[model samples]
Target: MGRNTRKRRTPLAAKALAASAALALGGGGLLWANFHASAHESHHDVAWGGNRTKASTAQVVTISCPDVGQKLTDVPARARTEVAGELAGLDRQITDAYRRLATTRDAQARDAGFVQNSILQPLQDRRAAVLDRIGLEVTRVGGTVPTGLSALATCTGSAADRTTGGGQDGGGQQQGGGQASTGGQQGGTGQQGGTGGQAGNGPAAADFVDITKVQPNVPAKPRRTRSASTGTFTTRCGVNTNKNHNTDNVIVAPGVANGAHHLHDYVGNQKINAFAGNDTFLQGGTSCQNRNDLSSYYWPVVRVQDGSQDFDQDADGGGKEGNVGRILTPVQAQIKYVGSPTGKVVAMPQFLRIITGDAKTTTNGLANANAHWSCTGFENKVQLTAQYPICPRGSKVVRTFAFQSCWDGRNTDSANHRTHVAFADAGGNCQNGFKAIPQLTMRLVYDTTPPTLRNGQVKNAYAVDGFPEQLHKPATDHDDFISITTGGLANRIAKCINRGQQCS
Candidate 1:
């Protein structure tokens, strides 16, 4: 059987409190795209991005010990001592591995420096190897060791102690029995204090894999585009609409009302009025419901490829121009007729909603792979707040924030509620739907002692025993029916047997 090499992330409830703290920090700038916040490009939520899937603990245990017994069963008695010594050495290595992992976790919390290659992964791998060797030796010796024997064993008896001894699996610890794997599930919340936290003059520890850098396919900075629609507007100035898209006919004037010489009724706060010929036009309120609307534009700093300037593709053009870009309001104005006939003018925001993405692609893009919803069901405008990563440790994990909307993909809402935004790839893939989307994952370094038998179990012989005294016990090395170790010896042996069968 081929070895499983993938690492995954498990969501813990601890993440929520951390997020809340960040939010209270008044734009900690770690969650989304805001003027005052840090860019959280590394805290990506999609799987394959920072959200890499984690493997079950049991599977990792099996992987750590791939060859459980063959190495020592046939050795001479003189070499048996050598084997025992080697097994003891393995036990110590496993212990050290776990201790180092705990230390690493503490180091990450303090923002101390450490690399995945030099200090973290090697220790984990070594722990796995040592546990494997011990598991094999224990299996060869026979069934689970008696309570008395356990006292003499080389590894920690407690599961957590065994795990920290080697730090082998990605997800927390493996469960005792059969259960579904949780490798690719979205992370719930993480613990408070962020990163690994502070460690006193205690044991050394290691940090988990920064999920941000896990996938090569996911981009560090995604491409975005922004476009605006021409809309009608009404202000204290006179109402005017040049059929031509040119701005030549628009005029700005004081909102203050003059004397009866230029009589006019002020609409709302508007004091200026438009006149047709010599007569003053009786103007009413203006609503630009179906009229042209004013627009705004914003371009972002793009993450370059190979240090070269390229096309800025990620700009989602949906906001108003300049000052109006952040917040949009409905426009109202008055329109004067050419005939001087008494009439009212109403102006409303021509564009009540924003449609994002490249016009060419929005009409047609690759199978909805990169389009994320800034808004919800109502198409309400989304106010992007902050975006940045949790940690920049080698992996490129990123998280983002915005005032959640009603799932309308809009910005206008009568009733205030919690905001919910959907995340997806830059290509337009959404987190919604069936297929598991790549997000973030942590490369956890943990140790666990392999399983050992409980005390007081009845022992049995290897040879057949159904018959009477005529049935003879087989004189062989395969006499034991169980084993005792800090790793998964039976699983490894089974794997090796299966592989041998395949080759045969």
Candidate 2:
């Protein structure tokens, strides 16, 4: 976005099926049975037979399963790889089941039990099998497995209201009429055209709010103390001009292809993928203006629903997984590091990984949801989390991610990839046993047309790519960062902050 403004017109080749083929080739092996058991358990029965009418009356929009990754707070070093792979398998199972649900709408209309019996039940069985393997792997390595793993295997069908696309009023309260407006203005009532967005899976008419009508919700800034660092450092990283795009997640599911099940736009480090190791990052080239900053930054790509398909239209994490349309690159990508407001900050450990928001927020609830959506002009006045802002002409859309600023000081990574880092408190103080570190904040500005709502339908909608079952909801938007700054560079940043001087 800084220099390369032209969009890449040529579509890349579709991803090969070698990864899936490899999995299939091992189906007859013992590892396959351990990872995927054919035996089905009926302990957790779904209430579908008698709830047929209810299911038919209210459409099931997506599948919701407990996120096993979030539950695994600790794992022995030897078992981490195997457990992570099984967790990825759990996600794959859910994606496969969602595809089944989307294509069987006709069957669901005819039989109320179709979704439950054919989709959810089988999904539960597959998850249970994977969960058991995860438990066994941890226990086999002398690590105590987290309890209640079996209880998390069961999944249920989630309706639209319970999901991110659910209707909400101006104050962020759930409303039955699908209205989200402020100052007596009514939002879109375009229900005649059916649910909007791609594959009828997201960004409903209720998901948009006129930014002009939103009230000023920005809180007052915290008062800085005498010991405050007060300085900042900025890094110039182009807005993915080289088009480093992928569906793999090196942080969450290392060595597994297509683990994310959604496309990501990457900036900074050039040699990142699901199979990349720490050594790869240390030796890799970068896109940042400062070669010393070899860190990696990435998030899900935002796509415009303009009736076109990208190269991955038929591939696993693209259109085939319900993420369709033309991808939009941001116009400006600002990466900055700010000092602590309470005291001098410490240098972060090299290779430290931090994931700010929850990608499964729609189903996992709002405990860790931190998405902030607004327009460039209204940044100081309003920030919408669950709904996309319909900006006035001349104002561009913006997405901001304020990463965790406190570190546990013991590990660069955690089993869940979160416990090692945390956000500062309202008073800008780190919690007990945690130390303050320079906060990394990314601000991305997009030059795109604001979507419009007419007759209760959304037109020209843009949404963040997400998990197949996540429906590309705004709340599921998240960011990932890997701190690969050289030790000398990190020390210089800390010194600049402590001296109250801005540096690059």
Candidate 3:
């Protein structure tokens, strides 16, 4: 929805946009997953991007309604005040079903019937028409829409920790059998009937070790500039130059386009995408310096184009210069990590994907403040624009990425992804209730010069692989990841981050 920057406060942490209210999503929907935090949650069994639902012709989500009739007793406050007339009645029915299902201990017994009937069925039947009405109503209301409005469209369940802007909750059972973040380090729990009732635990000297936060955070982040080292407990993993990709546990449908948009640059376990299972690569091989490291990492390929330049989307027919041709592999990659207070490392969840940068250069197109762009020798940096500053005589251009290190010690991903993970402090320390993992730091360096030949025979840069029907431009630059890293590797990194070892 917006730029894929790390959340900045400490719920694991992200700066509060407005102190904790319901979250706002792409098309004006709000999501709220009021779940308590927990600790036993190591990795998630769901897809990489969280429990998000898409309108699929090939895949149908069948939900059964409660035995209760299609009437309602109480209406949501937002619906009462914000929703208009006939639509208001429909909104109340939807909310009432959710309310019943929310408190029903045996909700799962219906075969996810409640969700299929209440949320998905009507949505599927009237996709275009319903969305149109929702959009119209959202505009009439000053700021709020019906609270679960977007969730119906997405089917990501009732909301877990907030992740993206859409506010889709990942708490309830989504896609049949997947775990949502019930409780995290702060001692919370999920609301689902399956594992929601299970008691959480503290660190055991046995298999599950506690990863504490680093204090005084070694090196503080420099103001207005990127810090190479916060002197934190981050370590670098290995990167392989192999050509392989696997799609299993992800949420991909045979012909759906929502899961992945283009060709991906994969590191570590080869099999990954919207359809790869979490266990697919658990014992899989790696292309990193350490063969033991199995964390899967992926992102859209960066095509170095003989640009007509970016940021000129509507201005100069420069759209053709955005991205095209074959997606190229990174010359080399480096895996960086950050640690917890006690400097213990835990297993990263599956399908943890983050998209940064805009795909187009239109002023009206969505862009993020966190999308950083700069040249090696030039001190100035840019964000969310297709425009790139020319580098000096021999310097290279770069895209520097810093993923969140601190986790809530529970959920693998929040609705927006960033909520369960937050940015490291200036001191590189996590927030009060959060634990630290290996924060991801990446740099995709482009040093090649554009071709000088003609016949219109000039060189062109390509974005990640797609259907060739569209171009993947600079504005759309982003990254994807899968946690296939072995458990042993995590512990060793914990040692390094704890002892402050700069292990490669």
Q: Could you say which candidate leads in TM-score?
A: 2
Q: In model 2, which runs have C-alpha deviations exceeding 4 angstroms?
A: 1-61, 105-112, 158-195
Q: Whole-model Cα lDDT per candidate? A: 0.19, 0.69, 0.35
Q: Per-residue lDDT for 1-504 in model 3, tens only?
A: 112222222222222321222211122112121122133323222110112222111111112212110111122323322222323233233333333433342344335565556555554444335545654554554434434443344333432222222211111111000111111121111111111100110000010001121111112233322322222433234333455533211322112222232345667665554434555656566666677666666655554432233332332112221122233455545557654433344545544433332221111122121333345643232221222333445765565555656668776544333455655554555678876666666766665452221221122322333211112223234455555555466556656655556775
Q: List, residue by residue over 1-504, the lDDT tens digit for candidate 2.
A: 011111111111101111011111000100000011113322211111011111112244555566677667778878887887888887788777766765665667668887779987887788888888988999998988778978887776655333333212223211111111131132333122333565556655556778888777666666899999899999898999678999998888888899888999998888889999898898778899999999999999998886767888999889888788888999999999998888999998899998877676555533455678899888887776667888999999999888889999988888877778877766788889999999998999998888876655577788999876555557567899999976498888888988899898
Candidate 3: what lDDT?
Answer: 0.35
Q: Write the per-residue lDDT of candidate 1 for residues 95-175, one digit (tens) a residue.
A: 234334333443433343332443335644554554455445555665232223222222212222112212112232111
Candidate 2, run of 10 with poorest lDDT: 25-34
Residue pairs of candidate 2 with colliding backbone atoms: 189-456, 190-455, 190-456, 190-457, 191-456
TM-score-wise, the better of 2 and 3 is 2
Task: Report how far off residue 235 is in candidate 3 (Å).
Answer: 7.8
Clash totals for all models, in order? 138, 5, 75
